[model samples]
Target: MSGSDETSQARALGEALATLRRERGLSQAEAGARIGMTSQGWGLYEAGKRSNLFRPDVQRRLTGALDATPEALVLQMGGEPASPEALPATGLSARGRVFDGAPLQTRRLRLETDELAPWASAGTVLEYVPGRWPRRGQGCVIQIDDGAQRVRLYDRADDAEVVVLGAGGLDRTERIARSRIQSMSAVTARFDDE
Candidate 1:
């Protein structure tokens, strides 16, 4: 392709990437980290100022980072057709590793709090999936004390306690006795548009 054609393709691809990132609620820094770039680099790409758009390795990393198929990225870049399998899965199961590889096996539940009491409130909906205790110090959602309390669970192994950072910034720290923890999942999704 001509130089101008390449630049146009890069610009198209960049726009698609930016849209996908916004749709997925990822910050530029977060998306850049996933693709091995700094936020500034990502910004340049999104702005279509970067000339090198055909780097296979960069393309692959962008696909993986965006959880999109290679074909999709190609299409977004105004390239020829590619297959569906060439696209990556951006599902919860695939992205669950952010919570220490915990399997989110439970059905999704949505809850809203008027005040940011035990976690995030009112304007946000939280995804609840049940699983075992996550690695200590990692953030998770757990049902504590026989399911009586469900809150954002964080483990402080040094103190041998589990602390809950509730909505509205309420914190509950409790000793880590062997009581039933029910299950732990991640607050995978939250909305703060309000």
Candidate 2:
């Protein structure tokens, strides 16, 4: 091997952290102080001159001090960061990781039954946005009593209740009391196997 993976990761994280600190207009002393470290200590990490900088706790503490986040450094370390537009307005959020190594911005649900057929069939993967409300006539995932959620079309929703329709037709629908809904999300995309 050319070099240890841990060594390479440390160097990359250090460079990224340094860039992040500079972008925030903070000297190493100020940044370190916020995270309860010394200028020389922080500099070691920034210069890839220290090892503990790569630890998870250190990453969290240091990044938090810089008024940025580990996710920013994650991207800087050459890992993909989900698009800002796909993220929550005021908090950290990510759907999950995919095996193909591409960044994904939406939550996924696998269909187990053809009950919602035509719109989505069994084994189909549905992608949706958490904390997002569906537009009129859009598709969405509706949770029923904390069980596996179901994917259905948006019929209508009001403060007291939400009405979701299955693909069987407009005539087929279930009205869920707002209180009964464990959670709900807006379906943004769908995928099917070839």
Error of 1 at 109 (Å): 1.7
The residue pairs found clashing in candidate 2 are none
CA-RMSD of model 2: 15.8
User: Which candidate achieves the best TM-score against the true structure?
Assistant: 1
Could you give the C-alpha RMSD of every candidate to the true structure, in order shown?
Answer: 11.6, 15.8
Off by over 4 Å in 1: 75-80, 83-117, 120-194
lDDT of 2 at 127: 87
Per-residue alpha-carbon lDDT of model 1 for 93-182, expressed as tens digits? 011112232344644444445433434555555554454333333345656666554555454322123445443454445554434554
Judge candidate 1 against the unseen true structure and give its global Cα lDDT, from 0 to 1: 0.52
- Candidate 2 local lDDT, 67-113, one digit each (tens): 46778776655565557566444322223443243453578888777
Evaluate residue 144 in candidate 2 and report its C-alpha lDDT on the 0 to 100 scale: 74
